[model samples]
Target: MKRIPDEVLDHIVEICNDEAALVVLSCASKRLRSRVACRQEAWRKRFERQFLQSNDSEQKWLHQHMRAKRAATHLGDTTSILLFPQGSAQFDWFDAYCERRAVEYRWRHGKYAAHRLTNTANVRPRGVRLQSILCAFDYSPAGDVAVVSQWLIASPRQSAWFSEPLYWGDMDTEDVVVLSKRQSDEYLVIQAWNMLVDCYSLCVWHTAAPHRPPRTIITDKREIPDVSLRGSWLAHRIAHSADTGQYGAAFVYDLARGACYSDIQGNIHTCCSLNATTDRMRIVCVEYNKSTSSPVTIAYKLWQVAPDRAEPMQCQATGRKAMSLKQGDIKLQRIDDGKFILYSRETDDLDPISAPTISLVEVVDEASGVLLKEKWSLGIRVMDIRSIASHDLFSIQQTYDKWLLLSLIDGSEVRRVHFNCWICSGLYPPDDQWAKMIDDSMWWNPRDDPTLHIHEEASQELSPAAIVYGHDDAITVVDYTGCMHRSEHQQGVERLSIEIRNRRIAERKHLVAEDKRIAAKRKLLLPEGVRMRTEGAHLRDKSKRMREEGEHIFTESMRMRDEDSRVYDKGKRMFTESMQMRDEGRRLCDEGRRILDECEHLTAKLQEIRAQIRALDST
Candidate 1:
């Protein structure tokens, strides 16, 4: 009501945390509307409560919560990840959430629409304008029709860079390995391994200016094959050359500034691992003695690539502080902060005193190479670690069939999950089935076939954290968060949820109808030539009308001018007469003044007589 205070309404809104309520209240009265519209602090509080405060930091957390919320809604299993339209902005929390929601929806409920690229003849299709697609395919951020294959990015409608294709004929699809591709509103950076030259090529292109050829830089060394892009910075490793005999180097390039920062070289064999954080990149390398086979000296070279402290590319070889390990290939896994897990697995025979060592996992500071804690082991030996999240390291021990997740910080076991099937990771396909998949034309589509359909709805009791699709097409997600299945909730919210869904459906339909109406109206518009002809004809008619009106206006304007001049002449004569009258009035006023002066003197005497009479009367 108008009588209700805005402070009361604001308090209610804050307590309710309902944007819809806020909208309704804003429309109720002008004063309320002003408060709602002008006050950004209220919106900030709402944003903090709805998005930030309730642990929406990690993508995994969002994925689990949204899915759980959807399941609790009692709707069908089809959950949309991207519930809202994507907002266009860089590093917006709301925009990120929208994109991530869509991603989660795609992973869960979205169906795949397959588009044929190459024809049966292993060439571009008849209507298609794109060149032949090369090796692997990577999708753009807006995962629609376009497929970025090797150097050429092709869409169903047409290929990008239509006039001048970016494809180099000499470069093979196999040779051009795409290391990392980063897309922003202003620019796109495709860092690919130029295997032909044995170097990494930083391909930068302006999305706004697609006609201009992309700027590219081929690294001087061929050994830096791998590249990782974090925000505007790119992290890469320098290849180890036998001729140089020095440890491999790590390079960091700022995409925004176009500056390169390299780390000092140590006795590195090859860059074993590289990871990029918010601002810096950590590179790990291994070094071993070439001569002595027995008691073989092994060490890891740790280098950091930061903006201010980055070593120059041509910096002299400084001896890197080595973290000593024994008898096997050393591997480094980067964790959160400047920490990493240094690990190696081996069967020892040379050490006579101590029992033969099986495996070792040690946590160390990535920057200083200092041991953080004593090595942690849970009886079994782990060969490799694979993880979806940075904090959770998933690995299968040498003796176990099931994969176990270990905390990166303390090397403590988080959980163990069994997988019936899994796809092997490598460049080469493991079997004929995988080889067939790569060759098959229609294998990549994510459809609801007998092979791809999950059909695990009946077993909702086993809450899954994620649903992973393996080589066999059996879908199963790693379960830990317990949100994969049906969730129990307080009663009476079903109707509310249904109402909300109905409202959304209505809004969507209205938008679609509006769009269609606009489109149809646009289509009914005249063609360019027709429009131009019509506009020209209209202009000509308008000009003719304007000319006729101008003629009439000109005639009227001349007549009025003549009348105005006659009136002005008459007024001038009248003004002269008035001036003479004013002079006569001035002369009369002077005469009147002289009379008034004499009258005043006489009045002074009269006043004196009156005063004397008044005095006599008083006496």
Candidate 2:
């Protein structure tokens, strides 16, 4: 392996897509280390391809160094969404890429510190410590605690001025209405409804100006419609109901400029989702055809939403007929120009025998009609798809138990969580260094590291930066923001993972050796020792027979005493206590058996010691 030329090895590492494998391969020799360092250009390209591309250009993450370069090109008007809003330093592209992998490793293993929403908030009470659970998980569900809909969003170590908890109380279905991705530090969007007035209000609460009243717009609807937030715009749609002659009007509200746009949507399904961006929005619903004569079909409809209008784009059927119950949601994303990806998880009665339940469909809305081009099965169910903070990776709650980080660009699974814990996305920490989005290419060994041993716990996704978990008594906030792009932490962690892997291998070998030693001990006890033990067991059989007879007599006597001695209840407590213990005759016989067993053990030990001595003398 060492004899390979440096030129060939450099290409080998360049082709090595796995981060863990690359890091391990780098340790193979000095030439490989130099080869990895030389391929910084390759790392930068891979990093930019994975981490830099978001749906809209506004959301595309830019590093500080890239910002400077773009600033020069744009005549100092350099503006783009920051990959890590909290991060200030300029990192090497290779360093950023590797650090991004380390951060994913933290997510794969569920490594974070969790304080309750209350504890992480401003109201730090004296007894709040009781609610806080501190540990790296083994993936066990924190005991079943009631789900808290209330939330207080603030950065860790916000100064005394921002220390007070921003009180956002419970919603019937409490999901935070995101303001601007950048303005998230200062303002938060919330929903406040007046049941009596039947008016729903979308309000923006300012943290710094807590004394001032919130700027709000009244959503003129009886019930809250399905709302989706992206950047500064909030788009919501009411489900189409035929009885009321409602065509399911969808509304897009620009929370930034106080402008509203509406369009009459045709029959938006109840269980559909609306994905929004600054420029455009996409909504999906189950397509139903009311024809008793027609065959049963399971199909869904997609609609492209403009600022002024909405149009149903296309309808694609899963080629499945559900005779029984089949219900789930869908997620939509526009990858590139004219290209879109749809992930749908609808139950089918014949799914287990047919194919995987979740469908990953890549389509293009072209004049040539290519909506169902490349569809693949994910082998897991999708609860929600979350963009990992720093990378182009997306986290999917696979089952009720498992969570996986998937490549957002290609929808390929990167790293899966160690424990089968179910985590719901609560908040996403900043995607600081998720620059070049791809999975680390290490051979996955679940029990390789103790830090990754997790139990099946339930948590939520807060942000790409942090994980919010609720399993037991309190809701916990698990922050993974530390490993976002810390250079000091990155190499050390990769090295530590290697160390842990080696240590686990050594421990397994030690266990195998111990098993062999025990096997050898059994072999030594096969012939003469077995005969002696058999004779000893034969002698002890008489003692056991005597004890059994005595126990039977005691049992019969106790039964007679209970039935007949009810009137004469003297020393009844003592007699009952005596029944719990062996009688004197049985106790004596048992003591003799114990002595004989000890004698056999001592004889065996003596023989082992003498054998060892004889072997030493021969040596």
Candidate 3:
């Protein structure tokens, strides 16, 4: 084949619709990969376009799925791309999207449920997963499905069946409801039958079929103990492997039959490896022995599940065995073609073990088994990995990918990752320095808004937390506990008073300079006599107005300063009180020590007296 020109190649790569095409081109030559990879924006645009190109029916199906999943996951705004109103007194505000206008939403807070109503009479309340009450929630790409597991309820009597396996969805136009029905007699019971429930079941509502009651497709309750939905396929442990003494299983589910099947009974972990493509389904399986101290190696088995086929035919394992590494927690990412990337972390040695070193391993097709490639390793420990933007990986700060890691870690450390994609380039407030620069930009007046005030008694103290950029340029400060900072967080508001005062002073100086410049220009423009007369009167009137305005500004500034000072004083007082409390505690400790010493001395004397009494008794 004639070597394609650089420009032509770039164009071809840019327009490539298929991810496989892009990957093949990238692997064709170093120059091609560089050129194609550099065009990230093109890829993003293409991906978005493709995503939106789905037919209305598909779109509706996807949207409904996403909505159902969002409700089932109860992930809140973190996982939701679309912002819906949250009607709780705690979360009443609406943070709008870029293209979408902000609409008023009504929030109804109930003891068991919180509902958010949009301005339109549509009563689609954000559904929450029951597991979100106790455990974390996981959602799929289309947002049509979710899985929640490892739930802990508050009831005194704890039972394994107490774990909730609930799903939420819009039952009708008027009401959004949870699928799992609770029994009236027992609080944490779901159906009187006690079955070992798999928390991660594919609960999808076929909204595509008009007038059809949503059908919940769960794994065959007999085969799989715990099943999780991975894209289109349901991943579950069908049965324990008799050969390896591990859970061997398949990503088996009968869409037509509404059942699950597995050929080889190898120990298969839950929904860790089902990557969904348009036509084919990819299943990843990792084999490990807990008894032996052997490194866990991941293997892949791809299959094409067509609507016509009653059973999904397992295709040959095209990819290589994942990089041979010591067994630890493994996270898989479908890269391209039959290739997969595994993010594995070494288990910590601590009692309540911390996260391990995160390493990325790539598995590609090889002749015999699979070609394993270790891409990179990071120094910092990763507790979790979440893909914030599709195709964009988001993780805490680590050694590798320095700048991106730094931003992510900083944002995550300060609990700000939910607000913005701080790791991505070209976003507002360029970096941490830029964030500080903006903080220096504006001055606030205490009298204008109590929130801006720095008064000791009047102003509340904001907690020592960092600001995270939200959608658009909006910033939200979240505390350590992951809750949004409230007004009371400004309890130490006084510390920032001086900075506010200085900012006001600087602003006033700039205004004064601008006014003087205007006056001087006016003087030069007018005739001599006219200039003299106009200058005197104009200057007097201008001075009067300027003075009045300046006075007003100064008064406002002073009020702000006073408020800031008060806030500062309050913080200082708090610090002082804390110190005093500590000192008092120390003094008491010292007194206690002295009393203990005296007691020791008394005990010694008592011992002598006892000895003397013993001698007298013996005589």
Candidate 4:
């Protein structure tokens, strides 16, 4: 065994592909143990084979595996005590990967229940309409503590319809938005517009004491005031009305210290848009300026707002630049670093012979101030976008039709889910027609026609364990807890597969114990063949019986291995078929999109021709 070549040992290890089998083989000799322990590549290969496929990048696969492992290790034995059990950390990252996929799949295909908040057919005297979902939080999977808000009500009370209300002060306001942090749950900030007073106020309340009066800041209403929060730092943009004209200013407030930096403003000139990093340490501000002479060429100013590293109290602005934007409603967002900000703007077709288009997204590097990523979406309407800071994942709501969870790492869509309303409509031509009608009409804008109110869904970190979304009156929770709620056929198949794996493991352990017992018995009760002179016949009988029993156990073990192999092969075939089906479905979706684009073109042409005929007749 010591003389065995490394190549031969490597081949054996690769073929076994099982950590338990490799461990047993390593114990056979010190040389083998050393080879296994020293070879990091072997462990990497084993990890990939257990969790990822050949097409997956080895680096990404390793990174994901390590991340999952770290998440499990930190949770410890309490992992199993949660509402959604993540299994034991010792079970390897394959278990974690399975759990992750289950969660994604549940969100992709799960059904949602909608609870209407207002009467669509009849208008009440109050004219209450669910304007927007400001912020949502779900801290527990057991549905213990939940907090969600529409433009009207922002509360922590868990009520189904519109029964219970904790904080209803914002309900009477025109526009309300909430910004809060999960890492620090002490502060809850609510910004609401009071039309009667013609003023906007920022109300900061301690979550522990909901009934208490909050610290407030009152100012005139602004057009697009943005608020961002991280840790104990809160940054916001205020639109202040003055004697000359309307202008905007950015401010930062330390909720912990109760220090407002409104007086010490330095370089932040204008505020068309404002975005901050997750740490709230960095802020990127977008300011648009039009020259008195050149109205056509509007310049944009991008400023990097950072806190003094040495002195946390002092804020400084270093990077400043200007660029010209041709057309669009430009929006800037600070993603992870000051070097890159998510640049999103909307552009419509210049010619009326085409359908109006929106939703163009890009990532711009501030060093050169150049757009790095090409426009991501064309001819797609986007309602909202949210980013998962830790995972580099972007969740997008595309035209109230579907939700796409996209990855910035690979620019690949991680998951796509059609809206439950559209799904219920069978996702057919009628649904497409209805979606187009909604897009063209002013139905979505409650301000235009409140009776035709439609609910919108956006991504929120409702809980540490779940990605929660709200639409209409219902709150949708996305997590692995829904895996047990699968169809009957799927549940049965999963149960059978688990049973096979458990049986194989149990049989292997039993066979090893039996072999050890037989060896011990032979050593105690039997003598060598040369020493057995008078009792040779009796010894032969005992030896033959022992050999037969050992053979029986070996045969049973081999049969079990073969059965397990067959089950694996069958599963592999099924997985291949599923992949093929998914590919086919994607192709169909692409084809449908193309057809819809052509139909829109034709409709626009027809409308143009009708207008021309009407003009000719009038002449």
Tens digit of per-residue lDDT, candidate 4, span 220-283: 5553266665546677776544554655667777676666655323323333223344323444
| Maximum-TM-score candidate | 2
- lDDT by candidate, in order shown: 0.44, 0.47, 0.39, 0.44
lDDT of 1 at 607: 100
Which residue runs does candidate 3 get wrong by more than 4 Å? 1-233, 239-247, 254-261, 270-274, 277-279, 294-311, 318-329, 333-340, 345-374, 377-380, 388-392, 397-619
User: Which regions of candidate 2 fall more than 4 Å away from where they truly are?
Assistant: 1-41, 49-91, 108-187, 196-198, 204-218, 240-245, 256-258, 270-278, 289-301, 305-360, 365-399, 402-461, 468-477, 483-619
lDDT of 3 by residue, 1-619 (tens): 2377767877786666565456666667756655665554565454344333122212322333343334433443343232222322221111111101100000000001111111111122223312211111121111122111111122321211111222334422122212232111001111111132422233443212211233545433333433434334444445464555565465455443465555644544433444444344455555544344334444444544543556555554433332333454455644333333455543333223322244444455566854545555443444445332222234443334422322222223332222222222112211232333323322222222345232233211121111111221111221111122224323244346557768877997999999999889877876786868988999999999999999999999999999999999999999999999999999999999999999999999999999999999999
TM-score of each prediction: 0.40, 0.45, 0.36, 0.40
Q: Which candidate do you rate higher for TM-score, 2 or 4? A: 2
What CA root-mean-square deviation does each model show from the true structure?
Answer: 34.7, 28.8, 30.0, 35.3
Q: How accurate is candidate 4 locally (lDDT)?
A: 0.44
**After aligning candidate 2 to the native by TM-score, how far in Å is the CA of 154 from where it should be?**
17
- Tell me the tens digit of each residue's lDDT in model 1 across 1-619: 6777768766665575445556677678756654554444555444443333212123224433443444333233223222322322122233233333333333332222212222112233223221111121232111111222211222232212112223332334465666555543245566556556766666666543333455675556554444544445566566667776665666666666777766545555445334444555555555665455433444554556566554433221112222323445555544433334554554332334432222233435456544534344333354655432322344544444545556654556655332222212101111222223321111111223333344533121111122222222122232222122221221123345557667877888999999999888777774765888999999999999999999999999999999999999999999999999999999999999999999999999999999999999999
- The candidate scoring highest on lDDT is 2
lDDT string, candidate 2, 1-116, tens digits: 77777778877886776766787876787566656755666777876666544433213223223433343333422222222223442334655565455544565544544334
